[model samples]
Target: MANTPQSKKRARQNERRYAVNKARRSRIRTYLRKVEEAIAAGDKDAAAVALRAAQPELMRGVTKGVMHKNTVSRKLSRLSARVKALG
Candidate 1:
């Protein structure tokens, strides 16, 4: 119940931000899924490439406040390790 004008504006802003963040999150997941699929298919080169592409997107999400820095770091670390282990 945002009765105040300021509160109503804030609610609208929140909705817009939520939609944008949701899209960003979905985009990130799509990138991650590409890497995962590559890994699952045993394509080390493709997985490595996908991981490389995904790194910046994930970091950007962190910078945009859509994701936590450590969360992205841990994900990148784990994914990198797994990619490295792929032979």
Candidate 2:
């Protein structure tokens, strides 16, 4: 219940961070969806472009602590492979 002042402050901070992280995660997902949509549409060029655009956003998620480094790396590798296979 956050009886202590410090605890209350921490709870507030957590809420703000949660909102920011949620937005970042959503943005990353949107980028990933763009890549997926392009891939599903069978446009290699578009998929490549979408993957390229998504890479940095995914890395940003790692740096921002919204996602793990290895997770992002694996996602990038798999997505890149699929995009390559499209050719």
Candidates' lDDT values, in order?
Answer: 0.98, 0.97
lDDT of 1 by residue, 1-87 (tens): 999999999999999999999999999999999999999999999999999999999999999999999999999999999999998
lDDT of 2 by residue, 3-53 (tens): 999999999999999999999999999999999999999999999999999
- Alpha-carbon RMSD to native, per candidate: 0.5, 0.4
Compute the lDDT of residue 21 as modeled in candidate 1.
100
In angstroms, the error of model 2 at 85 is: 0.3
46 in model 2: Cα distance from truth in Å?
Answer: 0.5
- Number of backbone collisions per candidate: 0, 0
The TM-scores, one per candidate, come to 0.98, 0.99
Best by TM-score: 2
TM-score of 2: 0.99
Q: Please give the RMSD of candidate 1 to the true structure.
A: 0.5
Looking at model 1, the pairs that clash are: none
